[model samples]
Target: MELRQLYYFVKVAKKEHVTQAAEELHVAQSAVSRQIHQLEEELGVKLFVQKGRNLQLTPVGQLFLKRAEAILADLERAVIEIQEFMDPEKGEVRLGFPHSLGISLIPQVVASFRKQHPNVKFRFKQGMFPSLIRDLVKGEIDLAFISPFPREHEQVCGEVLLTEELYAILPPGHELSNRHSIELIELKDETFVLFSEGYSLRPIVYEACQEAGFEPKIGFEGEETDTIRGLVAAGMGVSLLPEMALFYSGTLQPVKVRISAPSVTRTIGLIHRKNEKLPLVAKVFHSFLLRYFLDYNAKREQ
Candidate 1:
């Protein structure tokens, strides 16, 4: 019932070792055990059972753990909200981005945003599409940059910044590498280097190839854009990558040809929790990013 008891229970549940949890909490081992026991006594339920040297959560413990974690997270967010509300311009924004955007897009936006709001702080998390979404929904991150923008999620809302083309990246000595633009079908017979199954880009590329009347033969699969580009540059296979990943790609330069026929593209956007208020600092960042990309895309069109 007490905050400290819930905190202790959650930590012990996660680490599953009272001694280790106490070590991390910077508290005495006996104190941690006493608090956990008090918590169980108050609830009249055994939260954990000993298994070998570790503790395993019982079914009730598992359910209580979720609620305890959520309560802690809500309290943390409330504290941040109050702090940010005091001075929105000087508050912190927790932003999440995918690996694909880390090299160029994110850095560019963050650098420019900092120039305008120098005192504003940033906490960043770089992850894949699913992880980013998970963090956003869980309130772990205030806002996130997502691609192939999610259609409709019950717990999320998003706005597309702009759509960017996906290029066919060929190894240096490939036969059609000289062409400025080529059809997706042109690489049908060539082995393809692609993102692994769970990545957002994988499905987009697959559907593009299928639309072009050939199932791509994936010769190599990778989760990182740099890895995929390296594979292509090393003559492992060709790949379709977003425009941003190809910029300033040191030494390992894959030949980036335009995907003319299918014109593969994906939407890049910002997503946040649905029906929830973003912290003041996050709201400022969210607005700034929308305007920034809007102007960016407008200039590109002009």
Candidate 2:
């Protein structure tokens, strides 16, 4: 039976009088009577015993009345749960970001989001861009912050979260360390500390140097951001990194460089699959990140 018909049957059972039930439901007495009759016939059971001007519940009607109340209670609760998800102040959110953000930005994003939505719980994961993209498409991740794409992968949507400047980090008192900028050609003779193969920035870093007419002397490669930075600080060699990376890793005292190459930029971003529907929590976190980083950029630009 339709939910509306069930509702009428329930109200009539409660009032035990067709006229009073209709008054409470704001429906005409005849409409309420007709709806109950339809529900009883649809259920193939006689739900009421009729006397002069009042009704009593049949055995079947007593059982059904209880079930109907429960159904309506569940329906009411479903509506409330949906509204909570839409409210932004209550929902479960899952976020994935690169290790760089895991250290610097995600904590602040979590703390701030929690202050407003104390009830919402969050799950955070850190992975490289390729791995995070796979998780997003596979439905294992709701939202991601990642490095810029190496190639346009299928079925993924992305927005640049922040454009960060790259700096050439070097040991204290190194000859070129005090300079505001350095040309790639000037470093041709120097050994370079590079991130190990498969790190997202490798190709871009190498290619930028090639365009500047030199292939860097790769002396060492590292797996962790801090390890690479420490190698640079220890006077082992110099390296290049996005400014956002530097903020989380104070392993080295870094130097700012006016990188004089066309491909001398870095982007951290929000990513999700194109056809994926974000859980309400993920959407809130995504929007908050966009605003948080935008606010950061505004202040930095000023």
Candidate 3:
């Protein structure tokens, strides 16, 4: 039976008067009667009987009325929830980023965004560049913040958010600590502590070292920036890291110096699947991040 017929049947069952049910439903009395009659015919059961001036429900009518009410209520709730999900002010956004950006930059942006759009919830996943890209491609994450900007792909689109110069983190008492800036070549003989192979920063460091006329001698491989910083502090080796990485190194802060000659930097970008529609919440967040970075870059320039 049609949903409209079920609705008419329920209204008639509730009021127990066809005339009043038709008036409440804003339909003609005959139309309501015909729909209810159709419902009874479709179900092969009589739902009501007229006795004197009042209508009484049959035993089957009682059972059907309960189920009909529940179905209508569930449909109403489903409509409301769908509307809220499509509303830009509500729903959840899944975001991905590397460990370094997750430390502060992402948290700060999310906090600020929540102040205005409090109903927009967030789910975050932290991974290296390769993992982030893999998740994005598989639809496990809606958006990602990737470093050095990802290469152009037919299935992916990216916009550069900001660029930060890479710094060399040395042990506190190292001789180079006294210099205002150091070149990558100067550290040619020193061992390096770097993120594992899949991390974006690892390749950036290796390429920069090669550009400076020597291949880096990797002494230790680490998964987290904190661990890498600790290794540097323990004099295991020096490392090249972005500004945010150094900021969150906490108590294990090593000596951070700018790379002077053949300066190296990494670009952070917002990336998502190309031509694929994002959920309303994710789209709102994507717009907010674009504006957030624009304002952030302006302030940094000042």
Candidate 4:
């Protein structure tokens, strides 16, 4: 019923031990027990049952825990919103980005933003495409840098910052590596290395190949950009990689061949909840990215 009681119950539920939760909350074990008992009595349900030395949430308790956690998260966001509204320049931005952007795009934007607004802080989380969109809809993140940006989702909306081309990554001694640019159909017969399923890039590559009239023979599947690149470098198979992932130094690098005919590409952009108002800091960073990339594209044109 009380905020303190909810807080105590949630913490204890997660840790599954009153003593540990008390230690974390910097309170005595008895105080935590008293709060949990009061919360259960008010709710008229047995929240937890004892199993050996640890406590486990009952079926009803598991359901209550989800609601309690959501309430806590909402309250935390409300506090952050008010604090950020008071001092937008010094507030924190919770931003998500895919692994491909971490090397270049993300750092570029963050560095430029901080130069003008040094006090503004950033908390970054790197995720795959689906998880990025999932977190955006769930309110876990304020804004996300996503690729092949979602267009028709109901809960979230995205804006395209820039669309970059995807290139054919070939092994060192492949027969067609000497070509300046090759068509998608040229690689149709070649074995391909691709990102594992659930990655957005895999489908792009698959569809591009399909559009070119051949189902690519996937030779290997990898989770990371560098892993696919490494597989290609080892002559395992060729792959289609975004421009960002191709930046690497020293040896052990795959040959990057441009995809010309039926060109492969993906759009990079930011996504946020459609109807909810963003915290002031998130809005500030969001606007900064749009302008920064505007100049970036203009410079690229000239």
Report the lDDT tens digits of candidate 4 across residue range 1-302.
Answer: 79999999999999999999999999999999999999888999999999999999999999999999999999999997678666779788989998888877788889888999999888888889889988888878999998878888888886899988899999998898888999989988889999899888999999999999999999899989989999999999999999888888868888999988897889988889999888887888888888888998899789
Candidate with more favorable, higher lDDT: 2 or 3? 3
The true-structure Cα RMSD of candidate 3 reads 5.0
Task: Provide the TM-score for each candidate, comma-separated.
Answer: 0.73, 0.67, 0.75, 0.73
Across 226-289, the per-residue lDDT of candidate 1 in tens digits comes to 8999989999999999998888647768898998898799999899999998888788888999
CA lDDT scores, all candidates in order: 0.91, 0.79, 0.90, 0.90
**Which candidate would rank higher by TM-score, 3 or 4?**
3
* Residue-by-residue lDDT tens digits, candidate 2, 11-75: 89988999999999999999998998888888999999987789999998999989999999999
Q: Which residue runs does candidate 3 get wrong by more than 4 Å?
A: 1-81
Taking the tens digit of each residue's C-alpha lDDT, what string does model 3 give over 102-209?
A: 778988999999999998878899988778888998999999999869778767797999999999999989999889899889999999999998888999999999
Backbone clash count for every predicted candidate, in the order shown: 0, 0, 0, 0
- Model 4 score (lDDT): 0.90
Output the worst ten-in-a-row residue range by lDDT, candidate 3: 244-253
Which candidate should be chosen as best, given lDDT against the real structure? 1
> What are the per-model C-alpha RMSD values against the true structure?
10.9, 7.9, 5.0, 9.6
Give the Cα-based TM-score of candidate 2 against the true structure: 0.67
Residue 42 C-alpha lDDT in model 2 = 84
Q: Which candidate do you rate higher for TM-score, 1 or 3?
A: 3
